[model samples]
Target: MKNYKSYIIGLIALVGALQSCVKDSYLEEVNPNAVSSDNYWSNLTESEENLTSVYGGLLNQYLWNSEVEALRSDLAFPRERTRPLNYGYEWHSQSFTNTISTHYFKSWNALYRVIWRANQVIDGLNGMDETFKSQERWTTQMAEARFMRGLMHFYAHSTYNHGEIIIRDKIPTSSEEFSKPLSTSEEAIEFFRTDLQFAYDNLPNTQTQKTRVSKGTAATVLGKSYLYTEEYDLAMPLLKDVIEGPYGYSLLTGDDVSLLFTHAGDYNAESILEINYTDQHARLIQTTDSWDEEAYTTRWARYTAPTNLGGGGTSYFVPTSWLTYEYSNEPVNPNDSRNYISGTNIAKSVPLRCAQMIAVVNDEESTYYNKTPGYEATTFSGTVFSHFKKLTNHDIVGHEDEVLSTSWASGKNMIVYRLADVYLMLAECLIQKNDIDGALGYINAIRNRWGLMLLGADDGTGTFNDVTYTKETLMDHLMYLERPLEIGLEGYAERANDLRRWGVTKQRFEALAAKEYNVVNYNYTKADGTTGKGSLIQEGPTVNVKTDVNTEFDDAAVNFIESVHAYLPLPTDEYLYNQEVN
Candidate 1:
């Protein structure tokens, strides 16, 4: 129902259909021979093709649909922002049910397809001739395939009905075994750990091809897998190795940072592993008309501030005021310089204007030097909101005629892993292990990289900003804020999982939702069209007319976030076909 055409094609290609015909009575011959299991792993080219097919399986739309969106947004259990239509909010209200049957089927089928392909490749490589035995090449390819398989398992485990779901083993001719009983979360996590560990052990530290996975990439992912499994001790060393490894990766400079989200930066050194997409790449060809455009068409308007002025519209995802306020409330004298406001003021509503005006009066200068024209003193009315500026590159305005083109054509490379993530994950593991000083050291290292003031005693930034956090609470908070801010929309899909894993969805929503005002800053223009300093507006206690504020949050709001919702339901069709197994 959800367009299984591509998936079917991938399966057919990867798992060729075979037919047998009898020629002679004594010695029957096979005719119209389909791909046989015996011949599946015969060579290097075949193995490479299988690996390519595996990666292709992950780009299916069924895996990135409304159900996934609900998992990410605040309308359910993890309310980071207070918007009425947030999927989290809707689920919380019981307005909708998690019946994404089609999506579930697609996700399950595609992952199995990837896993099957990986098995074929692995098997084929094992049987390769001596001439094909380049340890470096074979190991790299195998590692990449394993990483892909592990990533799929991770998603499967994370999304499958709270981790009680079927484990697709190899390829199935019928839906029988595939539709079997669900595995426990612990089982799924173990599978993921094993796969990732294999990848980490075999992958190279660096590669001439940026798109390929390296030792660090695999190690980082293994660390993440361990973190998800709550194996802090196991995760920490792997993460630290990634941080200190010679992957030639580091934080992008102030100027180069903007390039990270664009098409030109795809598969750069900073990117550990990423799903490659290109306007020109055949595998990534998706007709824009079919995909949802909410994110693309408005020039990433919903995600950031307005065009020409910085902020954009709020119909799509908007960062919560609580997040903004946290940044604003950073210890002033010795905060990360990167924490300062930058870029243009695009909040055109009255409430936003009021908040910006207030921020300016409070001396919150623009962090980015360049300001968009015609955004001085402008005010937005409805709910004041904050947005990520990382995706606000102007070159992508209306680049596609279909669902908003957050497409790679806009120069935004989707990062699956990076050094920054590695550092933070290590910090998290250390904290979970009750190594407070060790955790702080890793966190401070990241802070220092961003030119921000360090925390804890002896970092020379004075007392620890008066913020007291137990090891678990502080690590949780750091991951929540830092991951979003650092990764932005690129990792938006994972937010809900992080919230669930930390058991802080309800707490974050409650704490963040009670605030009275949400502020957004943007450059504004006067009646004469002259742009000047951005003014803040307030949006809460009712929508302010002047700023065009349209978002709000209240204390009575309850999150319908369920621990169960963290895992997605197994596809019903699989079970239906395999009723005997069920």
Candidate 2:
């Protein structure tokens, strides 16, 4: 079994173990004596503690919420696709046989337990007296609870099983409530909308920390839910509220853009909702050497980073030619300005498929960037294989001494939702409404920040001209081209869900596996310690050496991919255990 202990972090040991949306009896309260069962949640301080646990649910990393999200999308290529632990990713990536693998059960169980806790928190807050806490504070806490409940509901709805999932607004203390029938698609979407509406109405305009939810956060999610359900008219106004709202959110500019990945930029202005991760010491409490709280830090850098670069990573997840060459286009200089070395250290280079791993720089040390033959890598296709740079702060990471294997846990805070995403979605909404000019304004806002040309700007590359865009044309660019490039491999599972909803599984993956595209501006240092830039690209790069590049799209995987339709099968265990799902 892949370790479920770490995945089940910060969960309180209730009377009955948390399972599905059905049990309120596990509401473990203080005063083991008979102080009356009804008044357990009588104070505000205790209610806040319950609220914190609901937020703690976001800390689990082993499930599909984090690294696996990237692995399943076209944005990332896992090193080992057939590994038992990776089945959730494989299933979503259109490769799994009709089987209930570990991933299927893990993701299903992890999220539902979260919903259970959210229900408990909502119930506790509702029963608490207003005199114990301020009317303002109590209501805000309730809004946050509803927000988590809604968000998890949406996540479960979109991530694994879609329409068949249940919605529990009230605390389920009865067996019938726990074993309720699966809801209809319309019912599930409305459940998501209802919770988000509650959150949007009561949440404050802004919060001191990005970890907390706000009106903009709720609005952003509500708008996305509306768009997903094809309620474009409703989505447009909510998106507009986020775009022009008083959330104080703005896209980071110039070299500051990399703050989205670095620890220095935690809770930066662009972040609307950021999941916080701390160091090993802060993430978990050590009661003894062998016994400790679960390490709730994110394992993203460990899976995505290059093993050679002190990250102890497999560097398994790389970018595709379709994403890098065919779709992630460049400015006219025969180079991707987005991926190139700008005059400053940081820019839009992170979204680039390939990355440079910089070594440590101290007074007594020789500060050198890694570019070894076998150690420094390239994929089989001959174009320089890309490595993800957003996972770490561009430093060497080693494992903790107690662990035999390398686990470079950087514990970086992940930005869940932000203003830039709002802008892009707004642009999409505008395109659907045939407001092309309004759409371009949002699109260009992202492009201009990264030092790329605005939509109408004449770069000699012939990338863009003064042609007017119809709904189909704008959507084609935005869907396949713009959004994929802008939001690739950021660890939100955003890209994969988009592909699943768009229904482009077979066509997209088949074309990606067919041929390799050239690596843009492949950079390396010579044996003499001199940097070299191999220019005039678009030739496929074949791997001249053995490295961690073991994944590919073979015939069986692709054929099965085309066979899949809208609903991903629920785990067989779900049917066995729940006794109510179809």
CA lDDT of every candidate = 0.51, 0.58
Per-residue lDDT of 1-582 in model 1, one digit per residue for the tens? 112233334444554311111112212334343354467766665666566656655454444342344324442222233334454344433234335334455556666666666765666676777767775677777778777777777877776677765555453443333335667778877777777888888887786556566778778777777788788878877777777777777766544544454555656557776654333322344434323221111233223443223432222344455444444444422343333344533322222211221122123233221323222222322333333444443334432221234322232334556666777778777787788878777776655554544566553546344455687667766766666555444442466667677776666556545656633334434434554444343435434334332233333236344644544555655455544424
- Which candidate leads in lDDT? 2
Candidate 2, 219-327: lDDT as tens digits: 9999988877767899999988987789887888766765555667777778787767655434345322221113445556655554454333433455544554433
Query: What lDDT is reached at residue 298 by model 1?
Result: 21
| Per-prediction CA RMSD (Å) | 8.2, 6.6
List, in order, the clash count of every candidate structure.
Answer: 89, 7
Candidate 2, backbone clash total: 7
- The Cα RMSD of model 2 versus the native structure comes to 6.6
Q: Cα miss at 135, model 1 (Å)?
A: 4.8
**Candidate with best TM-score:** 2
